[model samples]
Target: MEVSSQHLLSNEYTEVYRRLPLKLQLAYGVGHVLNDVCASMWFTYLLVFFHLVLQFNNWQAGFMLLVGQVADAVSTPFVGFHSDQSDNFWLCRYGRRKTWHLIGTVCVLVTFPFIFSPCIGCSGSHQWAQIFYYCVFISIFQFGWASVQISHLSLIPELTPNEHDRTKLTAIRYCFTVVSNLLVYVITWGILHISSGEESKIGPGDAPKFQHVVWTGLSLGILCSVIFHVFVKEEGALGSSDVRGTSLRTPIADILRSVEVYQVAVVYMSTRLFVNLSQVFIPLYLHETLDMAASALALIPLIMFIGSFVTSMTIEKLNRCFGRRLSYILGVLMGLAACIWIKWGSGDQFKSSQIHIIAVLIGAGGSITLVTSLGITADLIGDKTSSGAFVYGIMSFTDKLANGIAVVIIQDLHKDPSNTGYYRDVLTYVCGGSALLGALAVISFLKKVRGDPLGYENVPNYNSINSDVLPVATEDIQPSLIS
Candidate 1:
């Protein structure tokens, strides 16, 4: 009996490694942590920077951000396409993914500081130059981020073929992301709370506090870039090229042809845009309507991500118990509930305890969606990530475009925060409706892609991958603008 058990254990270990190695999992996760921290710090503060500092109108700032996002969206597909087709490029010792990774790092390093301190705005010109400079710098930042993002995410399916392994990586990566975001919130709170003794709140002139994030983001971003280069290993080749879809226009056409890709895209676009709207509005809502302290406003993200990190470990189990689609539906509902409360229940008062509960609900729900969306994307592509650079790039494209639309809608609908109540209501209604629509989109995806082999129970073994590949689907219409 003992010999038999030991043999079974060895076999299990072998199968697990064949799926995804533990070291690679940790390395991928580290890169994800770095990714979120660098990205979130500025995005979280973007509206605040414009509203309180440069003093751009809500619409103006939103439009500025929109331009950058649109530019990034345009570049994502090309970036993905290039990376997918690439091998070791001219003189770069690294693989295809690594080259873009390095390029993105330089872009961020060169442009991040300039974004915070735009030349025109700091030069006392607050008109078109400010707009132009902001748009230009932000575009650079978005493109650089996309360059790193698409390549980095493409490594996931390349690391493993197992659906279960992908889910585990997703959960682990999401956990790291939550922890890092939590740290960002806490650090932001510390900076804001350590007031200059004039006022207990954060303002544009609060340079001393805001500058901390600049230095921290720059330093940590540099360190993480190094870590990404050192740790992330690209498989150099795909296990197979046969995939689902009907388009034969190009390899990118083939990448876009997968049935699961469309399904993933729909769900991702809806929920991701919803999440962005919520994140963009929280500070505005709390600061404008509730008149909450900046430190307290910062605490909400900390609380939300804390709730997410603690429970993120359970995402796989939830997916197991409920199936990925239904588990995602549950998360969407949680987000909807929180959003509705924000719309109606969150009265104009400084209620920390109640707000914390709201944050918990939003955080946990978001965490679930975050993990599943990423896992499903990897699962959809299977082991094709090595050759399907545009797969992840397409996913990035879908995500950024949705967010762009969301920001545009928010910016357009919201004239100003001077009418705080009306603006708050507009934001809540829009964002809440978005959550509802996102849930509906999830449901639609579930109904249409009913028999997809997304769950672990239905997962195919490595050997099950035969020569059959899905042909790319023809683009009948523009992508669904559900968000």
Candidate 2:
């Protein structure tokens, strides 16, 4: 009876999997473009906007970012827990994950524009009032951002059980992310070039340009979402042979007890901290320390993302050739080298060419580590598809909370006028330090895996841990009877 049941389920799984066309895959990948674009601006330009355009102090700007991060941290768990519910809520008629994704898309589309626009009723209000106004909008936008991110990510395990397919999906999603970020930089570059003089720095007059960016991102995001909803069906994505029955949500206690979960969490958090901090500070480093013109703000980041785009395209092949561990270590070394160069090699005086080189290295390194970490996360989850959202949520919770606090502390130090080259120090020590620590954590995790392959019993298909070798070839694994 058990064998027969497994056979029946396998047939159903194959049917559903086969029906998932390439167009659907492409649409699914494009689903998160809005979040990607918003994130680029939030990290790259939020400080610049608040401190320079709105005349907020360093602490104020940092606090606002913290507020958004806190909001995101808080919302992730709720979205994850609910979206994983086996039973349908009213919103789940369209599919549970899709419903949440749509809800998040709506919330972001409606609220994100207000963040960049001048305060409507209180444009000239007291500083505290303006701060309060922006905080409310930032919180809402962040909640939406988390909802979109977690729900979209959870769709991966549900969509298919094949590891290679999962990797392909993740790679495609990240490729879109790179493209979305590139679009943002290109747009910002074009707008800044036309709106301001070459010598002038970005200031209050540039608020409209941010608004323009927000609107463009929203327009593109909504269109892609429509395609996703139309093409991708979530029908065969849950528990049971028919894929319409209840899936047992993995208990939070079970998730907390898993050692591998913690390991992946550290990697994810550390990678995010490295990438986000560098992005946030690069514009400031250019404007304040180097005193580069407005165009450098966009041009430099553009170069960086171009490098990321190239690396992202090739990462899957790299992962196949070399295991996740070696690939990630290589990337971390590249990032560390970039950090060292920014710190000492650039010195008090540097050439434009040197900065461009640093940008490419940073971008390439960040892309590899980030992509590898996320792939590791999918592997860690293995066949535990029921609680996939919750796993992703908790990881993000740690990432956001840590990054928020780190940024706050960094900004407090930045507020001290006596400190020269503070941004440089931040880029070198803080960002570089994160890469080194993350590398250490990766080594620690591998050691633990080697000590006991069963350390992640909850994760059934950790091939990397199961064998002496780190990366299992794609063809060596068999498809599971149950998804």
Q: Pick the candidate with the highest TM-score.
A: 2
* Each candidate's clash count: 13, 0
lDDT of each: 0.66, 0.80
Worst window of 10 by summed lDDT in candidate 1: 470-479
Mark the 10 consecutive residues where model 2 has the least summed lDDT. Answer: 473-482
TM-score of 1: 0.84
| Model 1, CA-based lDDT | 0.66
lDDT of 1 by residue, 408-457 (tens): 77677766547777546754576667666766766666556445443334
Error of 2 at 203 (Å): 1.3
Q: Let me know the TM-score candidate 2 reaches against the reference structure.
A: 0.88
TM-score of each: 0.84, 0.88
Number of the top candidate by lDDT?
A: 2
